[model samples]
Target chain A: MTDITIDHVTKNFAIDGRSVTAIDDISLKFPSGSFSALIGPSGCGKSTLLRLVADILAPSAGKITIGGTPPDEARRRHEIGFVFQDASLLPWRSVMDNIALPLEIAGGPIGDGPRPETLIRLVGLSGFENAKPAQLSGGMQQRVSIARALVLRPKILLLDEPFGALDEITRQRMNMELLRIWQETGTTAILVTHTIGEAVFMADQVHVLAAHPGRLVTTIDVDLPRPRALAMLQTPAFNHLENAVRAALFGDELKAEPEPAHG
Target chain B: MVGPVVFVVVLLALWKLAVTAFAVPPYIMPPPEAAWTAFLKEADKIGYALFFTLRNAAAGLLVAFVLAIVLAAIFVSSRKVTHAVLPIVIGLRTAPVLAIAPILIMIFGRGIGTAIAVVVIVSFFPIMVNAMKGFSSTRKNALELMHVLGAGWFKTFIKVRLPFALPFIFAGLRSAATSAILSAMLAEWLSGAPGLGTLILDASSYRKTGLLWAAVIVSMIMAYTIYWLTTAVEKRLTAWRN
Candidate 1:
């Protein structure tokens, strides 16, 4: 079990010699093999939180742990996988080479992890193994990045708006693909996104966050069934859950607004 | 290609016209035919001098390329080292090669060593500066990806930084190549080396204006050829950009 635990983690950035709190003290737990989503508006520190979990950035205060180990140790052990907003594939490298990069960095394949070829097939990119990133579309490039992130078979997967740049149809298709991939790997997954529908669709639990001093406002449980399909998106249950998450996300602002009587 | 050929033909025609119309003295502005005749008559001597200059320039340019890449890597590896040494590098670059050539000749004597040293001094700055820029210009997300993968600094540099910097390094090399021949010739003039520059000097002193013009044209051709070669190599290596 490789659960992620964030204990009162806070991040502060010094801008122009003034301390700005990006993330207020926030605590959350992602159970082993569970899918979670962090949904909030811009400046909500969701990406920062993901970075903190991946050990790419250290928390200014508090601590983050994976399973029973610190994030850095987990990272050093090659237990963390992160996907950025951009694909970030090396332009000169082919799809196979880019996916195999982590394995090469680890000195070799780690404990029988999937081969680059296997990952190419897994990501539905079998014939284009030798294709350069430039030749591929944005969606295909993101697919390569996803394969790269999973190449090592990491225990925790952290995605910071990995599909934020795609069109709506592509985004929805990718969301379904990601869900399928998440279930197959059973890795503790956390997605940071600003889209409410995506958060509700992919996550078992939606953690709503507020900005200014980014802090968690609420966590809404999605009792949606496993092996979810596109048809479920139109169901009353999914709509109810979406509304619940939306309320948690904007409840304070809604309350602060003056009431309208005639309407 | 056709356009450049036409342009060159028109230029030659204008040169011939100017010499005939102005009745320019041969010592000051030799006719095109006289220069061509002189090139044919002294082909062996001029070819030998051209070969000597090119060899020295190639050697110096190679040394400068390796040194620039190594120094750029060192500078990028540590902020403290970069801050401490970059100012010194810039100061050295600011010193005129002509001013340093005499000192170099005094130290290395009138030999190939002085010629090569002069070439290196005149040609290394652009490559070094561009290499530094290339190494630093790697995307932030790419570096973060490397860190997340647990790649050490050396591995990251080899796998990420070096490849990313190739285009910029080639840009530096293209500029450097254009100057390599010119600096080698300048060195030959100071050191009394058997090179195109010395040949031009001897021809001018004897009032062989046609031979002098021929040597100048050959040197220009050599410089353009080197620049074209660098561009070709850059295109081949950086084909992924397309």
Candidate 2:
């Protein structure tokens, strides 16, 4: 029910009397309950695309639908949640406060069900409920942000570089954690990232975008099994996929240019 | 090198030493002992004036808080108006409150009203500017979170913007509160309103240096209490700042 459809979406920004196209005529459909990644270089509109779908930014043309309704309307009905590159945890709020923010603003939960304890335990931040975002490390903060996004039982979650700020070890762990959460929750999630390995490792479908008026260049189906372990990176198929995605992104450009002079 | 109480003790010691060393006349430079004695002797009169001035200062601060919030709401709601009027507000802030107090007194007349007016002008601008900064720069992620959470504008404004605005607003208020108390006394000085400033003025004119020093001490204590109270509230509310 939470399938997202973006049809001919475009975004343009006018800055200092100059018009700059951020995203141009990109159309795609994300099947229900699937993990997808929009991957590209910096300034390639991956983030912009997620923002458009989040209703944080409206597309200049075309239409976006989340669960058959406008993205903005869906957002307002608590049908979707969006996470940003920064943790975006309120510095003035505790982990519990941050997670409960959606409920708090909606004038408390009207549901007969108990509060979101599964999300709390999922992030492995059970003991840090009262702790503020500032007290936690960056990895811990990102975990809190993930918990916050999931608090309202959102059907579709959009993440924009949520782990881009973490160290490699933390990022890898978070990648695994995200897979676990996706499998458990069955939420249709979309991630925007610049890392090639990350896209192949986590996404069910990786949509590569070209920069400077960003448009979809290719869509690579991951075709990998669910609940993938970190050790899968040792597999030849994983290596082939990672290499292919990387080569598609950068290797060909380097090959086209001549080699540097020998030292 | 010194704790807060220790610093105060040091200051008191230095003041006593200066008066004693100079052998200054009791009428010209009363000793600290003499000042304390005078303070106790005129405790009733001093207490009334202190209470009155504090009441005005508190009222002035409250008014400033409400006004700053309303004005900041207006400013943030429109970027064009904010860009145009912000400079003017800053310009008014730069103008000294002491220089403006007499003109305010002439307009409002000499009373607690004039004193409150003086304090308001001294305290309002900074608090407002801070509120404006805090509200306008609400994190895009937070805003999106609120939006997706089905929060109405009122809910987002109250729960998010208000709480976010608090630290900066408190910072501005903490600064402004001190100015409010000081300038309340100063306004009394200019307008002949009945407070510690008037007491100091009266004591000085009568060459009662002991009373003058005593009133000044009372004034300092008042300022310290306001600072401590605001600081305590700030710490409690911003426990997340840890």
Give, for candidate 2 chain A, the lowest lDDT window spanning 10 residues.
A105-114
Tens digits of per-residue lDDT, candidate 2, B49-162, equal 888788889988998889888889789888899889878877877887668776888898998788878787789988898898889878766777777677888788887788
Predicted candidate 2 versus true structure: per-residue lDDT over A184-263, tens digit per residue? 77889999998888999999998888889898888888977878888788889888887777766674685686878999
Per-residue accuracy of model 1 over A103-220 as CA lDDT, tens digit each: 9998887787888898888888989999999999999999999999998999999999999999999999988999888898889999999999999899999999999899999999
Indicate the residue-level lDDT of A128 in model 2: 89
The lDDT of model 2 is 0.85
Evaluate every candidate with DockQ and list the scores.
0.88, 0.63
Docking category of candidate 1: high
**TM per prediction:** 0.95, 0.90
- Give the Å error, residue B170, model 2: 3.2
Interface-residue RMSD per candidate? 0.7, 1.8
On DockQ, the candidate that comes out on top is 1
